[model samples]
Target: MSCLFSPIKLREETLANRIVMSPMCQYMAKEDGFATGWHLVHLASRAVGGVGLVLVEATAVEPRGRISDGDLGLWSDNHIKPLERIVKAVHDLGGKIGIQLAHAGRKSESRAGIPVAPSPIPFDEGYRTPHELSEGEIQEIQERFAEAAQRALRAGFDVIEVHAAHGYLISEFLSPAANKRTDRYGGSTENRARFLRETINAVRSVWPKERPLFVRISASDYTLDCMTLEETLRLLGCLKSEAVDVWDISSGGIVPTGLQPVAIGAYPGYQIPYASRIKRELGLITMAVGLISSPELAEYTLQAGNADLIALGRELLRNPYWPLSAASALGEEIPWPKPYERAK
Candidate 1:
């Protein structure tokens, strides 16, 4: 079997292959954050198309944490059944599903209320200045993350990824450019990572040990003043005891637009080096993402030991059945859905 199509075990979850449908927000959820038919169809189609693991989009843990009003949420029990239906659909199609639990923080345009962050900094011009979270409020948000994990467990998701990247609440606290607090949650790298560390512990409190827990983090803020690769390494190293199973490495989104990395899509697998470095140094499983659409590139990345899994975002959105086609392209005879066997 080609490396891209080979099975890999993550904790007790054995993915059928290494092709992951990276979480991309659909921004199609209801105003109350309930999953609708669009979400069900969007995720299930990828399962039918033969993705190894289909991750649901960045779902908010609280109303104010949403990137917009349309983002999926798990802040309430009412959100559970809708997500459970999607999970059932994906499982029925023979694919494992995961959810990205996130908080957009100062980046939130949810209109729910004034967004909150570690500092009162706004994401960019024209964005509202976010409310700085106090110590008690920070702890409360951590509890909300724990509560959300419980909801995810009840929803029957096979994996739960903490979305700590992309200039969100956790990401805000992690980056000095965004975090200007004077408290323990905002000084040295250890202090900056404190929120994420505690958040992981909170989630792990309810999350099963056997099931893998993933954390998606931007390996770099792409600017010197913000989170650098070395900082990322140190930050992740400190979380080793949290028992995080996978580091889904993607870069940027910590800084605002103009100051972000210019080399993001300079080439395919551009972000693989970040994942490779993290995996190599930390001895952790890393998921390489960013423009890894081609079957050959995906296989080469694995063969070269750049990353353990290949995650695709826009590529998967453009072609839900990319994996099946990729399997054929690589000469691996993975099964197709019975209804689509003739095409195979």
Candidate 2:
């Protein structure tokens, strides 16, 4: 049997398979960060399409944390029922759903308030220079994360993945290039990891212990003087006591350097090695996310014990039913939704 179709358990949840639908932003929200019909159908379609885990896109913990005005937000109680609808529908249809709680920091393009970051660095050219968050503001941000996780609980989400990757708020703090603070929140690896550690602890406070909490990190910054994989390992070591259940590892985007980290002709499963190393050395469950678009390669990745989960982005966007097609490609039988079983 192909390992890609194999079941895996995390905390109280048992995933139907090893394939995860990685979170991708859908800028379709109507206003005020509410989930609309588009979101319910977009996520539900993937759940029905046979993904073991369907993670909602980067959701802002506060309104100012949104990457755009259209981004989803859980900063208020009113957002719960709309999201709860999607969660219940996914669960009823036989799939698990997770929401990636995020804060865009300097990356926020909402135009409502000045973006805030660990430092005053702007994301890149054409991006606004952000305000440096004061110590009090930092504490508030942590509480906001905790509050967002609490909202997730109320929304009936099965899992919560903290969005610490992709040059967002947490990623800005994690990367040295974006964070140049001389205070306790910067200067050393331990200090730099402080925000993330506190964020995890704060979320874990309100979030139930039995439910798994995942942390997505940009494992490598792919730039000189930025956080290297080694630095990330040291940082993760500091965060180990926080009890992070999984490391959804992705690299780059911590800085806006225009250069490609991989040379021309990068292939599938490019980021597996970084995840495998973390799993081997740090003893953490790691999910490899990159261009892992092929079923054969994804199966091989699991069979080789390179990574615990295979996260796909673009390919899944092209085909919500990619997992079903993949099962057929690998000559494995997985039950399809009753309405679609006739095609199977």
Q: How close to the true structure is residue 249 of candidate 2, measured as C-alpha lDDT? A: 92
Write model 2 residue lDDT over 147-195, tens digit each, in one string. Answer: 9999999999989999999899998888888889999998888888999
Worst 10 residues of 1 by lDDT: 257-266
- Best candidate according to TM-score: 1
Candidate 2, which segments miss by more than 4 Å at Cα? 257-266
- In the predicted model 1, the residue pairs found to clash are none
Best by lDDT: 1
Candidate 1 lDDT over 52-71, as tens digits, reads 99999999999999999999
lDDT of each: 0.91, 0.89
lDDT of the structure predicted as candidate 2: 0.89
